[model samples]
Target chain A: MNTAALHKNESTKPAPATVNQYTFTPRVDIRETENGYNLEVEMPGVDKDGIDVNLEDGVLTILGRVQPDNQDGFEKAYAEYEVGNYERQFQISEIIDEEQIEASVKNGILTLELPKHAAAKPKRIEVKVG
Target chain B: MYSLERHLFNQLSGLNSLINGLPGGTTFAAPEGRSRRDEFPRLNIWKNDNAVVLTAEVPGVDPADIDLNITSDKIGISGELPSRNRAEGEAYQRLERSSGKFQRQVDLPFRIDTEKVSAECRNGVLKVRLQRAEADKPRKIAVKAA
Candidate 1:
């Protein structure tokens, strides 16, 4: 229902809280490393061509469509999961540089590089004696 | 579209709807929206007496590329699924299968000793054995005439 609560939900599928929602969305791991925060999202069946990244204001968003092989009139014995689009939104802080963000889709896991902004980075400045 | 819990609830309501005049009434049918089936890998879960079996259809994953983690209540499979596609020409059409990093976590209903959890990957099928802890095993008591 709530995005904040959805974030805490153990069923960590990245999609928003909707009805009859296809929750095949797998859980993703977001960890903060010494350099920056590393997001390792599990997005299987998504190709590089189908994936897209967008940054607006201070928010970063990733979207990808998982298309299936054409198998018409196929009879399924049973299916416990559903397929569809993959979308995730993250709040970006001043620490991350918007222009320097680089992304790559290897296999299905899309790795996005958010380099630390120059201002957010710590720098040493000598004290000037008046 | 919905949370896994909601999906489960919808499924449960569908199952409940079949039997009318029960505690709950019919809800909505399977409404389609954002489909996540394509987002994650194809995984199957089976239950047995001693342990719960899990298998994931990982076509490109190497045994060495897979990582396994076991805890007191759950098991995690994390690793990179291989994906090196050949260059396509005019004849190339569509690519369906997925590759790259994948991780799956399954929670066992019954408590199991994590130390005893054994896993083996063969033919892209990962078999995890979650042995039930001695304390959680059901014990049979002697029947006495009262």
Candidate 2:
């Protein structure tokens, strides 16, 4: 997408552009186990329907969106922070088993499990007498 | 690691700004790197005429783990980001998220009604709402034509 043209079309300042969508990068922690690798991503305020995870061409992408929570009957006098969409991408190596990947989200954190392929697993061959 | 590189970059940028302050014949301009959100548990506090609202972004924290306290003029928030249990042979490749105890206290200018305060945790975000005390609310007076 040509985001520069979109930015130019909405060059007006002080007023937030309706098409302006910020991409927040969530913090990630990756761990490798004997069977596979685990990925933990922090994405707060995202509902179950607001998250999308896709894998294509050895690339895994995580996208999330959240609605701004505003209390009822309270007029905002000032705002010091903003909540926006989240996006992150990672490359899956050949050793990973693409067919057995799993993911779950809880308390704003997304955990992914990528198991390793059988061919990639280490093996020890026994010697036989000839 | 990315964190170490960003830390050194920030330190160099700080020194560069300090160097610019000295009387110099030449000023060096370094290209700025992409800004990173290294600070965990960012907070936002705002107030209206009737109440004050405070929100914090704290992902990976459970609702039962959070401890919140609110007085007439002060609010305190404390919580811990639990670390995930690993298997026997698990090894970390990249670790950036913070895991530990965090606490923050904010002082409000106007007194709030302790009985009316409310707090909720959803989607890893904490929102605290405090209503202004009856005597602390602004009063509107009408002037009659004399």
Candidate 3:
């Protein structure tokens, strides 16, 4: 099966909000199995309560919010990456069982399991010899 | 006795503040064609008069695999990220996450008290707090009228 044809990366602009924090596209790894698809998203500094996964109209959106570190008495000495929230969306095909999808986060990585519908699963047939 | 060290620290602080005061904060030096692979596990540092706190983004890396080496004024971090395990029928559709060994070293503006340093890893981010060495701190001098 051509997996790329099944999933399309949608470049949807984030909704304008009152917050001034920048939004970054988190890196991801997608894997296809016999039963379902697995998605791993990297969102550092984001805890479990800070993530939101939503599926609507065949589009799956993931948002990870990171609270800016308090800089009270400390001065910023150096930085290599900007602190911000994460947002990404993907257009999922009909083969994905959106209702059965499961999402979990650990160690700053979010794993999403998109199970395939029973009808979409491959069927095995046995041949008999006369 | 600590005038030279204080002067050097002030100069470094001024330069760092200038760079960090930009609209988008400090960015990679290269103008274009730069990738995250160039500097795996990017870092952000904050410091006060007595201590410095450093945070690094290292998602999907286990805490046991991370290694830290600290000295009076420098710290080195090295770690290996394990690759995802795949079964027989599983295949990758999109593999943007890189897994391999990475190492980085940073120099602190003030001497560190190795004994007072502490490190912790939570939710894929590593936070290291290093306290300034006692001997390196500026001491007030009393004046006596002759």
Better of 2 and 3 by DockQ: 3
Residue pair clashes in candidate 3: none
TM-scores, all models, native as reference: 0.43, 0.75, 0.79
Q: Per-residue lDDT tens digits of candidate 2, residues A1-130?
A: 1111111121112223335554555567777777777888777888778888887877777777776675666655534346766666666666778889898888888888888899866577989999
Candidate 2 clashing pairs?
none
Q: Residues B1-146, candidate 2, lDDT per residue (tens digit)?
A: 33443344345434221011111101122213312223446667778788898887788888898888788998888888896676776665556678889887768768999999888888888888888999998888999999
lDDT of 3 by residue, B86-141 (tens): 89967665666768899999999899899998999888889899998999998889
RMSD of each: 17.8, 10.7, 14.9
Tens digit per residue, CA lDDT, model 1, B24-135: 1111133344234443345555554455555554434666788878777777778885554333221111123345778777666667777776676643344566676888
Indicate the worst ten consecutive residues by lDDT in candidate 1 chain B.
B18-27
Model 3 residue runs over 4 Å out of place are A1-18, B1-38, B140-146
Best by lDDT: 3
TM-scores computed on chain B for all candidates: 0.62, 0.69, 0.69
- Docking quality (DockQ) for each candidate: 0.02, 0.24, 0.26
Model 3 C-alpha lDDT per residue in residues A17-101, reported as the tens digit of each score: 7366656666777777889788998888888899999987776778888756665788989877666777776667677887899
- In model 2, the number of clashes is 0
- The DockQ assigned to candidate 2 is 0.24
What DockQ number belongs to candidate 1?
0.02
DockQ score for model 3, please? 0.26
A-chain TM-score, model 1: 0.69
